[model samples]
Target chain A: MAEHTILVVEDDSTVRELLKYRLGKHYEVYTATNGKEALDQIEETIPDLIISDIMMPKMDGFALQSALQADKNTRVIPFIFLTARADEEARQQGERKGVDDYITKPFDMETLLSRVERLLERIDMFQNQLDAEIGRDFSNRLLPDHTPDIDGYELDFHSESRQQGGGDLFDWTETEKGTYFLTIGDVMGKGLRAKFYAFSFLSYVRGTLHTLLEESTSPAALMGELNDMLLNDDVLEDTFATFLLFHWDPHAHTVTYANAGHCRPVLMTPDGATVHEHSDLILGLEEDITFSEVSLDLDPGTALLSYTDGLTEQHTQEGGMLGEDGVRDLAVDAYDDASSIQALLDGVLSQSASDSFEDDLLVVWLKRLAE
Target chain B: MSFDAETASSETVIIHVGEALDFRNADDFKATFQEHVDEGVRQFILNFSDTEVLDSTGLGSIFSLYRAISPDDGKVAFADVSEPVQVVVQLTRTYKVFRQFPSVEAAREAFAE
Candidate 1:
């Protein structure tokens, strides 16, 4: 269980120390000499429960509560009043001010602990609720289509589905050929139906890639055969996907990649940003399609950034394309500073005013082995 | 997107598939199929021997038609499902919704039974 945090706002060091002595065993105690200091304490770290005296110099408890409500950030923190006044009007005012519980001065230690314990329990309940909401949002973020994460790379993913689930998918597997196969694809629709298609498409591609690894070493040939099946025999007409397939040869320190109508990924290295715009035709467009492969020697500290159009399609209030260059700049800055890729994504997403997404965004960051 | 429908019996309808069944053409398929369902025609046989391709949306439309018919103890069959179209059907699981045959005559005969 997490330790409960309590902030006690009182001008008297004696009472503060007393409460700290009394509550220290049950809570992580923070003390403030006045309401101003209490608010400052809260601004830095929101305590699980706040206990404040009604009157203080510079800022008072009522004023602090009002400030908390006015600012969206600290409004939800629970507050309780510890006051000397026993007047009916004062008690009514405390209730109206939304103080969770009130304790009179010279109160019995048992009653005070009971009230504080109840407040902490309520805070714990709310925290669990908040945790559940975060869990739901994270699930929606990482598994929009409910496709299980790639066998070996589950932690390196996040998904956003607009209505049901997005069609973007990624998978990784180490082949018996002493190579690792990484695949990412975006099917051309949304919702459960689109999710089903995305899953079906990935199933076909991943199964075929695994099966073919024993017979072939060329990623381009595998894509060619997969495309042929999709184009010639697949009943899906308008159904198609833009995909990128990669084969990493550990022995040679090289990676071979092929693309089909997907966005050009930015490969960031110490030299600078290299745009890998390999092909134009989408899969399932024709019966006998051939894909070309690009071979590169993996450089240590090299990072490859691949993403769906959803990320690029996000526009500012001014309707500017978040654009390839904008993302490239972020990636370059992050790669140069050796910042985490997730941080780069968070920075870009925070810049947008609205959290609503137009389509699914699938992003992958792969780092080449460092020498 | 163009389709031709023939009423075979009080319980059966035959829809002819032509051109591509894709996002652009799904509306034509939906509009016609909905019209049949609205007309109290439940049983259906879709001739896919000539259809070049059926995308996810098109396959979904086929499933919707089957749902519309199967509830009334009606049936839908596919006639002359070409090899390529059959592959898509198999992948999508839509082929399981109806009895498919090599020729329209077989589909029509199955409907008679």
Candidate 2:
């Protein structure tokens, strides 16, 4: 609460001086003889509040308020009127003009101060709420940060909502047993609710993955256990998350992953593409559902693509499918310039607008680097 | 927010608000009660037992009324504020601004004191 700017408009020299004297104690006060000068000062520095005399030389407060209302920029500014009439008509007229509050002539200092203080406080609270909404939006656009990089192992990520906020996430961590754990998942929906569920799912997986490291290093078994946990949990039952569990041998140049009803992970090479197709059922589908794993041998510069259904489900403006071909073409073109998994994944996603993503999408790409 | 005012005395006004106190419905509330404020009716009983929900803007509306009556050495008291409305009023720190009573008679009695 530094000195708040208050613009005061009054024609009478004595009354104007009194307003300046009293208001200066609590605010950086600006004085204007009439409406014309007041409007000019308003444009120069939009004050926190305005107090104007209803009857002034040349232009009156009502006319000034009308001018302020006519312009969209100044319409919402808080205003209070000072009037000597103290009649019913004058009160009604001020109320009709959307005056925040009014004081009669010969008003006490305390009366005027109380009205001004209350009005200023309300405006401050409203501004704070607007700022919170923006911060929440920004965080939403950069969520679940995980994607395999060009190094074949490190995580990388880029969000369409980086400015506003985006959801899809991928991450990799090594266990105490010296085995690596990799997971990729997408939460349902978008905006604040989607962002909330995405973080919840990520936290559950973090602990679940650590538990799996103690028992087995197999990707398929991890998927089975993860699905069962999700199905049995009450809060998570309503949330549908698609995930892939992976174990890699960096020295042997091999990767094994179990897919849980997620989109097939594509292997992108300069020569062509190879999709690590899904042969298993979706997790949390049923108690008896089984998951499967696919193994791939990597060549240097070969990029693996894993993503949410949002990529393939992108549609054209005329409602035709950007389809599998549009997505494939994007991957093929990107393979030339996108050296890393993060780069390739972002390239394909950037081709389609965020609003066009069919569902919450998360993609992880990893490429074997040159020796 | 609309009010039904009955002059309890030359100096006091009983303003009964019988609907939702909100931005969408505040006109009648203001019009009915503000007329009394303008007449310098120093004491008031703002009966909100009938209001369903009071949003932030609605609280500001009441704040205006409080500011109006308090300056003239008059006080505004709440008569029979509903439980849920009272919860919102308390949560928004507005309950501290108004005097509350369980019944209209209690509020009127307090206003007289």
Candidate 3:
């Protein structure tokens, strides 16, 4: 932790000096009598981290934390709150305010030191990842690590996050009943916060899916339960989301799907492509709303093009967008010759304004190989 | 890309919407309308003639606006909606909540009395 700077704000002269002395040995420790002093000191020399006391003479630690959060430059700095041990109120407030960590008032010196070191190290690690490996790290944490290898279908998927974070996510599981379920979901909103919410939403779906599938008879039935779950979640209740779910029955050789306010998917046959124009209201919008199911028997050489709005909403060079028709035409043209979603996307993006889309893109191509 | 509004009467405000209203611009769109709602403007007429698409997030924002003003007997309507936007509205069944008109003038007149 050499060369790392830390700001310690406490009104207690004894404890403040002690922390300065102990932490000074390993870091450049700055002292402040209160939150006001801390702000003044920070304006001169921004610290790499902050350890603050909630009780102060003037301008409490919570106020200090809010000030830092309001400033974009200091918001990323890791903050540790010093709270009275066993004070549930302080702990809950700290959690609500998104404090990095907590050091109870009676904390051991060694524990505080170790936590400081760990927090700084973690800050550095995430900084490195954010600078260079955001997309890679995002996928590693959120997306399915590997695509499933179903027996009869050759499935291909392409996913990319615009600006390193997106609301798009997908997961597939092979059930014990010998059926495969693949779903591509887009949570409402965008950017990093939405990215995290997408993870939580997907996590809940993945966790409850197996049991829900056992009880629910069809895709639409399962969708109702999913709707109930969304409405029940306090955080996700107001956020609208679109989900496209596809269930493949190997024995029946058919794919049944249910759409919840998602874009209509396109079916690429040997002759041409047709848009499956069916949908329901987006989730998190209404209660008691139901989704409808559509099933199609897949022949030997049929492929389904399912994607988020990122594909169709991409800006064309003409300053106009590539709307649904353009996307359908491009998918049809590409599926005629290319066999991979990557190739199909490459063709679609070739005419787009840039190779990188402004939104998260997820494309799931389920193709039945011609025997 | 942009959100603009003009008062048609003491109660109705017609907003000119442009391009796409997905996640990218949904917040801005809502924020603009929120300012009007805060200023006591209730009834809203959205001009969707130029909008190409409305994503879930964008639709959610509109729903939020609907919730914000509906308690005051305020209403929201779409005028000259493009086919694409119409499809999304119909698909979501939001058409039941908000009526559509052929032009901005028609929407404004419907709210007159």
Candidate 4:
């Protein structure tokens, strides 16, 4: 285990020496005479905890706490205030400023030590919880690390959620017959609840796709079944998802796709770009709704891109959205520039007004290679 | 989110919602709407003219309010829905669940029937 470091700030030499002597056995101790000295020490090496005195020259404990809180780097470190004034007002002020603990002067040594130990343990517990939440988020929204190699085609896929765990999901898999099934979905909303709904939707689709595949080859039929399943599932009544499913047949060099109120997919050819705009009602809204499918022959060197609303709905500097036209223009420009998939996505993201999106974004790009 | 409720008539109430509605304020929205429902208001006009966005959770809250009032034969309607909100309403087919009108006066007239 690494040694825990503690910084003690006090103006009184006697008290400072006493604390250093007592804490030195268990922890590596550093001392500062005032807030300014303490900040300099913090800059040198951040300690696990800080014990500060309230009344000192140059800078007081309150000033130090404010300075620490203002800085992102030192704000999370546990802080304990030491004071001579035992009045309720002083203690309340410390509490209001988010001090971890307060120890009055002439206090019991054991009491101070125990409080320090408890604060450290609590910080550890909080950190553990945060780490676990991040782990769960990453696993639930896991993206494909590498695109599956398919004959006669080059594929690229990218997705980014506005939050750590987001509502956007995408996946592609090849069945035993070598048919590729690709799906992308966006659950309506943000945060953990949306992520939960997205995960549930993905799991249901993955489990039922094979059976639906055996029953029908039409994308519309598969979408209808999926819609019914979502409506029948009691948990999904209030929530809805916009989804798109695509089936690519390598032998026939054809692509058929169905949209459930998702954004239209853009097809880029040597001539120009066209958006496939056929769509049905979003899922989980009504029962027995039929989705429509659009099929197109995959001509050599033609590329297709599908994405969620996040990309097109992003606000630009002028407070206007980069709508479908902007997305198409960017895609065409990237294609003309002979850019890689990553570069194309970068071009799309650069149009956003901010670094992060208000909604989750996803894109799937596929191009048929020349024979 | 901010909600303002006023009695438009003895049987109808207008609830004006301000700003965006999503998971952040869904529970508050539900509670505020239910309070008026318990006060014996049978008809509700949700004013969304000031509402910029409504996510699924916000829509769910509206659905919950509908479920609450439907048992009593009460009705729910929307007035002055912005263009963006209309797209969501159309895409989710939520328009089927609630009646929409051009303005508060039109919705109040519809409630009289």
Which ranking of candidates, highest lDDT first? 3, 4, 1, 2
lDDT of 3 by residue, A251-305 (tens): 6889898988787899988888898887776776556777889999889888898
Q: Give me the candidate number with maximum DockQ.
A: 3
DockQ of each: 0.02, 0.01, 0.38, 0.29
In model 1, the runs with Cα more than 4 Å from the true position are A1-155, A233-237, A336-339, B1-113
Question: What DockQ does predicted model 2 obtain?
Answer: 0.01
lDDT tens digits, residue span A87-149, model 4: 999999999999999999888889998888888788778866875586457534546667788
For residues A1-371, write the lDDT of model 1, one tens digit per residue.
55789998888778889998998889999999887888788878888888888888888888888888788887777788888887898899888877788888977877888888987887778766765564445334333343223323222445565543346777777787566777877775545545656666776777787778889868789889877766554455445677788787656767798887676788878888877766535665444556789997767767788887677656655655565677787778767444456666766766665655555677877666455
Best by TM-score: 3
Models ranked on DockQ: 3, 4, 1, 2
Candidate closer to the true structure by TM-score (higher is better), 2 or 3: 3
lDDT of 2 by residue, A105-217 (tens): 98988999988989988998887676557646545533544433334443344444321222355667676745466776654334454455657677777878887778887
Q: Output DockQ, candidate 3.
A: 0.38
The C-alpha local distance difference test score for the whole of candidate 4 amounts to: 0.80
Q: Better model by lDDT, 2 or 3?
A: 3
In order, the Cα lDDT scores of the candidates are 0.71, 0.68, 0.82, 0.80
Q: Please list the residue runs of candidate 2 whose C-alpha ends up more than 4 Å from where it truly belongs after superposition.
A: A1-155, A162-167, A338-361, B1-113
With candidate 2 superimposed using the best TM-score fit, by how many Å does residue A242's alpha carbon deviate from the native?
1.3
